[model samples]
Target chain A: MNLYEYEAKRIFEAGGIPVPPAVRITKPEELAKVHFGYPLTLKCQVMSGGRGKAGGIKFAKDLEEGKALAKDLLQLVIKGSKTESLLVEPMVSIAKELYLAVTLDRERGCPIFIASAEGGIEIESSHNVLTEPIPFPYHPYVGRNLAAKLGLKGAVMAKVADLANKLYKVFESKDLDLAEINPLVITKGDDVLALDGKIIINDDSIGRQPAFKGWMEAHLVDMSPRERRAKMTDLNLVELDGNIGILCNGAGLTMATMDMVKAFGGQPGNFLDAGGGSDQKKTLAALELVNENPAVDVILLNILGGITACDEVAGALVEFMKKYPERQMVVRLRGNNQDVAEKMLAASGLKLYPDLEEAVKEAVSRSKNATKKPALAAKA
Target chain B: MILVDKHTKVVVQGATGKMGAAHTKRMLDYGTNIVAGVTPGKGGEKIHNVPVFDTVMEAVKTTGATCSVIFVPPYLALDAGYEALDAGISLLVLITEGIPPQDTAKLAAAVKAKGAKLIGPNCPGIITPGQSLIGILPGSIFKSGPVGMVSKSGTLTYEIALALTESGYGQSTCVGTGGDPIKGLDYQEVLSMFEHDPATEVIVMIGEIGGNAEEEAAAFIKKNVKKPVIGYIAGQTAPPGKRMGHAGAIISGGKGTAESKLEAFKANGVRVAMTPGEVAKQVAEAIKQPAKA
Candidate 1:
């Protein structure tokens, strides 16, 4: 789960890292009571990057300006995500900016610290970035090593190293997948402040972190309706703008099925992984999710039942088709009681294909035909 | 050579859980030599006639079990794994998913230190067809033969295995390397074992989007593996940065793309298949060809 700037800054403060004092405003009227000082930065809270480029951040020199900007930002939708709240903080005067972060290096299977002399918008293109792998329970001296690598010295250097160590401590203790302080600013007085912060908690570690469990509940409030419904059903559903709805078992096979649908000239409306060993209830939930989508013209069920028995899947499809007799479905069930599943489907006036290619081709053709019939009738 | 067979004595960790009990029955049904089971409080109870012990050490001491299949939940997987390692179990097949990456990294390091083999933390485990089963893969779809298989997926592996079985090619051993960023064994490591195994003449490698494991395996196959190798990659249509269900199945920083992996395989003299059926066809064709000089 990605944390808002305000939340991440709160964590940073708890970890003894210096951050600019900030207040969160959920309503525009709340901005009137804000007394952080003049020259405040109003940052729109959304779970996306490039908020500044998208006009989600505005600089207000006074209270009146801050209120107006907060109102505008609250109403703004950036990158398909609505701005739910704003982080109001006193803008800092920076003598210099640097970047620092800690994230898992998946290839090496370890945590690594990334640092760069250049920070802010152009950090991605900066050539001065350096990375150092940190062992578990990392040594405090490694922070100074990274600080020195970024060309820091004196009291400011010590402060930056101390901040780095604290950030790492927070990252490990919180089970965060990533903890980043972009544009760690050095004020004119040589005091370093984390200007902006971002942290992503590892989803698998959510069970162990109660605070993050609460954060996940808040995170779900921002999801699309379909996504929320899928979450309730424990289904992995990603909504897309297309016509054919795909239902399959396993992540890899689900993706492969979507590719096959696209290859066969059909647009996939959603990606749904029914997961392994899904019973009739989960299968029905999956079907209901796809059926709820108005854009879905045809539902395709592609399951290679290894741990999942085909007969159980067949039973669920039978139940769903019996209730929604008008909905079109194309299924290819294989492995583990496939013969029984095939027999069950055959008796129900539904056709089951043995090959995935055949099932995909049939579903694509059926969807094309279903769309054309209405258009032709309207023309006639 | 793949670390499991009929003679390999087995013990089950977290044997009282739903997954452990279910797959234990299936493994035993397939004639696996399951000698004992271990559940913390359910000691002395028998699951499917296999004696239960409180700890892995006790189970190993009693049954002389060489391998352990872990079915503990994610939070406890590392501890369970450590117990198995401490008991001197030679091979550990972790069937549990959702283990934290940090825990897995620590577990991998410990496994290396103990000179033990760890199959998966989110994987389907290893299966030597018609001999022994250490994971939850459906046994009906596989048959013992000259083909050796390794995959990063559960159902996709079954799909390819079914395709191979239907195409008259059976498997010597099939290993699911688990779909996590960090896992016990990579494709290269599993491929190395298959390369030297006298039973495995043809190798079928299944990979998905994410990680450079396939590229590394392709390099290994190019230089060291003389067996006919056929490969298939899933998630060709997966959008970048999307999790795609699996925790490790995301394309990050313009790397670990299915197209890139396929291109790497083609460059390394490994036949790449676009789909599961195509994989079986390529493997069959590879089998018909004479040995490379």
Candidate 2:
């Protein structure tokens, strides 16, 4: 989960790190009230890297210019993610830009800090420094010594070390995947300030990070009905802007179904797993979860039986369709007790194919025909 | 009868529980000599005629079971694996999930140091058809034949096995290495095993999006594999950077994309199958073709 710049700055403030006074502006009325003087940097709130190179950021010299810049950035789309809000802050006159980030070093099985003297650009110049693996329980003495060795001294080195220590704490406690205070600026007055911030929290850590979770909940927008239902059921669901809605057991099958869908020339709307236990109610819930979405042109049920019996899933399908007669579904059921499930499906007037290729092709054809006919009378 | 011989003694950790008992029954039914069982508090108990010990060392001491199958919970999955490695167990199969990533790194390191191999923490375990069934995969789908199968997804093994059997090709051994993001045995490890196995003339490798495990396996195959290898990567259509099933099945910043995997396999001269049925058919055909030098 990527935190907005303002959110990341709030975390920095909590850690006692110095950041320029910033305001997250959304509405036009809030934009008018910006009391910051000329020479301000307005950055669009986005999750991707290379936002600076993109036109999503602008610098303005006056209030009128700032408002116009904010309006332009607010409407901009950076890396397919729209800029719904903007982070406004006064520009700092920097002597040099330094890069500092703490992320999980997968190879070392621990947290690591990557500090570089060259920053503010995507690609640092030749002779840019990237530190060796610095383990956690981050010692401020070690940080200060390293900075001094890198030619930074006096209060500048001490302040940078202090910030590094605090950042490490946040990185560990928050289970952040990536935390970057790019351009930890050395101002002319020798004060350190974070000019740009990026914080990517671990997805699994959402359970522990209540503040981040609350912020995400507050910023809820563009959630599909299937997403809402899956959220209610505590299922992981992502509605891709596609045609086929896939419901399968296990992640492997979910992935295979998505691939098979595409191989057959169909796009997958979302990936839905019924998990290990595929009971009647659970299967019905999964079907209803996908069926509730108007965007889903067809629902594909791919289940490979083991502990999850095929007959139980087949029974659930009958019950669900009987309750909702207008639903269209294609099922590819195999593995344990699959024979009985096939028999059941045949009785229900739905042809069951043992081959996934045939099943996917049929679903795609049905979805294509259903999409082509705009009028199931268009009347009512 | 396959992958393992009759002399390969097996141990089951957490054997007093339901899953352990079930797998024990299936393994026994498949003709494996179930040598010992281990449960922390349920020592001295006999489940399915196998003596249950309080520790893995005790089980190895009493029964000489060289391999261990672990059915412990997620929290203890890594520790259970480490226990097997420390006890000098050559092969360990873990069927648990939610094991911390750090723990996996530790287990992988421990296993490497001890010259031991671990199968899975959230995997379905390995099976040598007609010899032993250590995991939760159903026994009915398998038969003794030439195709050696390895997959990240547990149930996909069943799907591919069924497809092969229906196409008149039986498997020599099938292993589901699990679909967890941080896993033990990857496609490269299993492919090496299949490459040397006398019974395995052809290989079917199934992978999902995420990591370079599949691509890594392809490079290994190109350099070392003696048998023909056919590949099918799941989640070809999965949204980039969005985890499909396994936590690791994500395409991030140009890596682990399905097209990249497909291209890698093609470059390695491995037949790429777009679906499970095609995968089985391709493996059968490759086995019959003369190996290209």
Tens-digit lDDT string for candidate 1 (B214-292): 9988988899999989888888888786677788998987888999999999999888788777888888788888363
- Check candidate 2 and list the clashing pairs: A251-B245, B96-B121
Candidate 1's C-alpha runs over 4 A off are A220-223, A339-347, A372-380, B290-293
Candidate 2 segments whose C-alpha is farther than 4 A from its true place = A9-93, A102-116, A123-173, A186-194, A205-225, A228-242, A265-270, A339-347, A368-380, B1-66, B73-76, B79-90, B100-102
**TM-score quality measure for candidate 1:** 0.94
Q: What are the candidates' individual DockQ scores?
A: 0.66, 0.39
Which residue pairs clash within candidate 1? Answer: none
Please give the lDDT score at residue B195 for candidate 1: 92
lDDT of 2 at B77: 71
CAPRI quality of model 1:
medium
